[model samples]
Target chain A: MSHVSSSPKVRGGRKAAVGNVGRPPVAWALPGILFFALFAIVPLAIAVYLSFCHWDGLNSPTSAGTANWTRLFKDPEFRQAAWLSLLLTTISWVFQTPVALLLGVWAAGRQRSRAVLSAIFFVPLLLSTTAIAMLFHALLDPNFGVIKEIGPWFGIDPNIMGSSTGALLTVAFVGGWQFMPFHTLIYQGGTRQIPQVLYQAAEIDGAGMFRQFFHITLPQLRNTITTSSVLMIVGSLTYFDTVLIMTKGGPGTDTTILPYLMYRTGFQTYDLGYAAAIATALVVVATAISLILVRFSGFGNMRSTREGM
Target chain B: MSIDTRPVTRPARPLNRTRPAGAARRRRWGNPLAGLGSLVWLVLVIVPLYTLVSSSLMHQDEALNGDPLAFPTNPTLENYRTVLDSGFFTMLSNTAIVAVATTAIVLVLSIPVAYVAVRTRSRLSGLAFRTFLLGVAIPAQAVIVPLYLLISKMGLYDSLPAIILPTAAFAMPVAVLILSGTMRDVSEEMYEAMALDGASPLRMLWQLAIPMSKAGISTVAIYTALQAWNGFLFPLILTQSEENRVLTLGLFNFMSQFGVNIPAILAAIVLSVVPIFAVYLVARKALVNGLMGVGGK
Candidate 1:
């Protein structure tokens, strides 16, 4: 055995000169490709195909040929859902970015107390979204929740969830509360990666704290901002669980973003065809937005910030 | 230039006057405005968490009638008992199985793909990599209806495999990206060294690539596990039976089952978090890094 192994090892050593030594065959990628194709890619194609077919998910799907597509264009609920999804995406991006950026920068500091507080802040991220939604739902219960006692002091109505705007804002707020820490951690990582020399240079130039932040930190985090924003936008566009648990797209479909609308249309109303159309549209929009962001920010290029260094 | 001279002359009189040596060295003296902002956010984070815990410990009557933020006069595990009695364990086990199975599948499948992508210089490998890159933006929500159809057609509806298969599939993109990233870091010389031993590609992967990419592997495992554990839409739409229910759906059902029983609901929420919280406490750096990896870092 030893003699045979030695002979092959010698041959392998010689073969190394040919440059095909230990490279894996492309066949190694087959199982994964087939599995992803079967589940993800195939299902996506079926969704688009079913978008043009009429199926109540019962007997069989019959070709309806642009019927569902036309309905989707003119459906008032679909229009409203599309608009609300865009609005929520904007709200989430606007609300989450500044706070997460600031908190991330702060937590990136080396203070011991900041470390502890950062740990505390990370607690929400550990909880499942279901738990956070449930916790917030219970807290916002008008008759029996903390909101009742605190609303008067804050000059706010306790029945915030009962109104349309309040309900939508509440969804955005709850989602923000759960996700801000994740973005903050991203920003924190980005901040730590910044070299200390930049800060020293700004200090030598008599730049105030605000000026340094505006000029040095902000520009340096441009990639981080794009990354966090893309994530935030896509995340909020598909925001569903909170709507399901808290609002159920209620108070007159006010909070019915696209995902929730898809859920309602497909499962509840049994309009699976229309829901497929909506789902396809969502995929297109999400992919388009990400592609645009990646294109503009050159994030797809994966350029290193420390190029010269 | 004038402003620069003023700060140089009176450096000790401004924000740096009362700071520690470390702060002065880094020029990160506590900004009062930022400090104030952090305090405000601290309150925002703490208040609801305080309410969740405090209310869960109270009797339902106390929770309803008393201040929601007050300390429970007589804290008890009775609510936790209530959650335990209501089949929380079954759902917990189901979630655990889903998480484990999904992680296993994702790792077993994605590692090879990632390895081939990183090691092989071929157009097929490039196409495979781009396939996953595009897969990243295809939200699982978009494919749910067809998945439901496919699962039902395959006789998988209302089964754990129904959840495991799709969840694992969706987690592939990130897992592939992360694994390929780490695999790329395994140096050429290392492969050459292994090749000199007459090692097959499989042996090279096991001995060298896998060991070298342990960080990315662990990150992928954690990401898939969390994705499976917290998955809602798949469970909500695909599965119907209580026997097949996972934790998130279990929590969703608890709302209607324990209606107006706020303490019971809160207790269920807290119990659901306990396992992940324990993991977070012990493996915080790994967990945070894994989550950051989800954003394609």
Candidate 2:
């Protein structure tokens, strides 16, 4: 009020008054800052610290130097989990992205059918991961699960969850199933953003549906594809709840991913230091990949512009 | 790019041209193929959900030993009764509290932060927004050990806040990203007019920003609620008691204890999903749009 009243006397006062009018953006941002600092930043810093120390929950830490890091690199379980995580990430890219693109294209063309299909497909995503895992677990039960009895006729192992490779692949497929709708929506939004004129022009040039799709639609969806891939990669690497519920990294660590490995090493083994090292590595890898995606793929710039829409 | 380079031998096509007789015949074939494709997808989508619902209604023995695909001739509430009787309601209540609290806090905290990030030119808000973006890439699994230690040290262990706070924290980056994006869509003239009418910044936000960004708010609210509701890691690590168990952990125990009781397990799964499904139905559009924002980010 004082700044406003004095603003008429000087130009600088008006600037200061505007800056201090009722409140600046910073005032509104304070709670979020504090919250993020405590929960996000502080815990992250502590995890980094814990990674360097050999501390159990029961006792104070002693410095382990890089022993935890050395062990993390050498631990076959960790290696297996890391490989599985990578596999899941790659499989999602190879499989889910295209499937999502196809679904998105299909959805964009037909509104009513899209609505019904979307409602059906997105159910897995909306339901808890634990619930989805449990649902699949039951559906694949060895004796009476519908899939179990039916799979053998099609040359699929009825008890796929009992084997290591089968378990990993099944979980990956489930992860794709759960998240494809999300990617579909992203691609659908991208498809919508294409100007109708481009398609009309293509039609006049004697381009059929396939040609139009291959040339214009595919090219226009590039950014959306990049964004969804980055998300799927990060999401797959961090996949936990479903895997934990369904297999508990069972059939001898086949389905274990980095996150589940970290959880098991930390909670079950009570080796917080080792687990923290894995955690630190997971963070580093995830952050590095995300940075690469944001930088090389132009995700960061593309997102803000797309989101602003 | 290819449109302009077509062969000269080909005649210029009529715009909005009608299909030739042969093309029309092909179209007749294509429609059935398209229908079949859609039907295949629909079946793929519905099969699992149908299994969940159907298995829940079946007799336990039949679900486990007989044909699991068959509809129950005698659909019973016995499985639901078994689940509910075994403290399902308590877990539901606990989940409700956590989800609602997390959503409320996220919406309240994110709105102003987003508003400021969108509306202001302040370096502080800009820095704050950048910091929030960093949170998006930080996986919760990477920090769970530290979170577990922190919660215990702060004496919040085995409590709902222990779970709620971290879940909400994990949710903030996306929430703020979404809300700020939404808030930026409001016209600047509206803000200026409100200010010219003797409105304070807060007043301007309330009158001009909030209403305009209601869709974004709903999206954030649903997303945060969904996260908190489906959260497993936080509650798994932070809380120890059955008293503190959210629906995820509760259903988990149901699975472990009643592993062979297919009906009971399905019943619990169905119970756990109902609330979230209800929310999804109500906010289906916002949820899709919200996820689109997430992917866009």
TM-score (0 to 1) for chain B of model 1: 0.87
Q: Give the clash total for candidate 2.
A: 0
* Highest DockQ model number: 1
Give one digit per residue, the lDDT tens place, for model 2 in A244-294. 888998888788889998888889988999999999888888888878876
> Fraction of the real A/B interface contacts present in each candidate?
0.58, 0.55
lDDT of 2 by residue, B65-159 (tens): 77776788788989999998989888999999999999998988888898888767778888888778657789998999999888889999999
Clash count of each predicted structure: 0, 0
Chain B TM-score against the true chain B, each candidate: 0.87, 0.84
- Give DockQ for candidates 1 onward, in order: 0.35, 0.33
Question: Can you tell me which runs of candidate 2 are displaced by over 4 Å?
Answer: A1-23, A302-309, B1-37, B195-198, B281-283, B289-293
After superposition, candidate 1 runs with Cα above 4 Å error: A1-18, A204-207, B1-30, B196-199, B295-297
Candidate 2's TM-score reads 0.88
